[model samples]
Target: MESFLETFRNLDTSQKILYVFGGAAVTAVSLVAIRILTLKEEKRKDYPRDKVILHQIGRGPFAPSMTPFAVKLETYLRMARIPYQSQGASFNIFLWTIRRHNKKQTWNQGHGRHTEEEIVEMMNKDIQSLSDFVGRKRFLMGDEPSEADCSVFGMLSQTYWQFYGSGYENLIKDRYPNLASYCERMKDAFWPDWDQCITHGGTREATK
Candidate 1:
């Protein structure tokens, strides 16, 4: 412990920063590797040839970006009782990039700053694609939630919550009743404090 403390104390500010970042990078890579290994081990043990794994990636709630995909996937999963893991992608990437480029003023230009027409057009495209995916089917893959459902839902839910009560509210909730209902069901089932949790936005609390 003394040696460790001495070594830590010897680190300069830059070294300390490097240590911190290096530690984080190592931890992240380790986690990814471990996850892969664990999945492989699980596959080996259970060896279900038919089983599929899904990965969903997206930004957070402020973007109003990925919710439709998530909502649709969640509904399908509930309807089908498919087990999945939800992974949150970094919204910080977009936020930081915008800030770094000093594009904050023009951030909404396309959606946040741009004309309402542009925003509407983007939303319409998203909705149309989502609708086509969901269609009359009970899920993404015909009356059953498959890997695709899980992947898409994670993204859509994040988007929906991020933009909730904002200008895009009607564009999402009002426009797609089935999708909205799906989101509500997911909230009730998965998010215990659905209203408060989803509505009040910040970093999502880490789950076990």
Candidate 2:
């Protein structure tokens, strides 16, 4: 142990980075491998991916077959005894709201049948919904950080914190301070390496 520590400390900067990221990669692989090995043979065959399975389903007339990739990241995290807030059914609503929000439009720009004011109003309605839904909790589902927190933080952080701000940043900050603060708190908690983790290439500067 002493020799290993000495070697690690003596390593060059690049080697140290490789060591850190490599260790993370190794830990992730080990988790998946062990998890798969522990399951029953039939279950193993069914769930090739770690604790998640996808099947084709009929989505009525418009789109006959849809393959929804169900991610059980939270479930897998919990099975491993990892701390995570269950996102519940709120994540689905969040996804739908985001999908409907058009970031390309401005206060005067109109697209399709909806005018700019109508679009902004619609987007604000969703944002306000988020503001109410998030409320005062530190995490999406609760005070404790969970997988749901990780997911929500990823999306919200990009808009508010990512170096190149998103098209809808103002819509949130002007009215949804709670959501903005939530993003900051999550960054402080799980993503101390926020600035360095995902480098932005766009011209826009980072906010807060």
Identify the leading candidate in terms of lDDT. 1
Say which candidate scores most in TM-score: 1
Model 1: CA > 4 A from native = 1-95, 101-116, 185-208
lDDT, candidate 2, 2-65, per-residue tens? 2222333353332332222122332233334434444454354443333333221111111110
lDDT of 1 by residue, 101-193 (tens): 322323322223544465446556776688776766665676544666555555556435433323453545767766766555445545453
- lDDT scores for all predictions? 0.43, 0.39
Candidate 2 residues lying further than 4 Å off, grouped into runs, are 1-114, 162-168, 200-208
Each candidate: RMSD to true structure? 13.2, 17.8
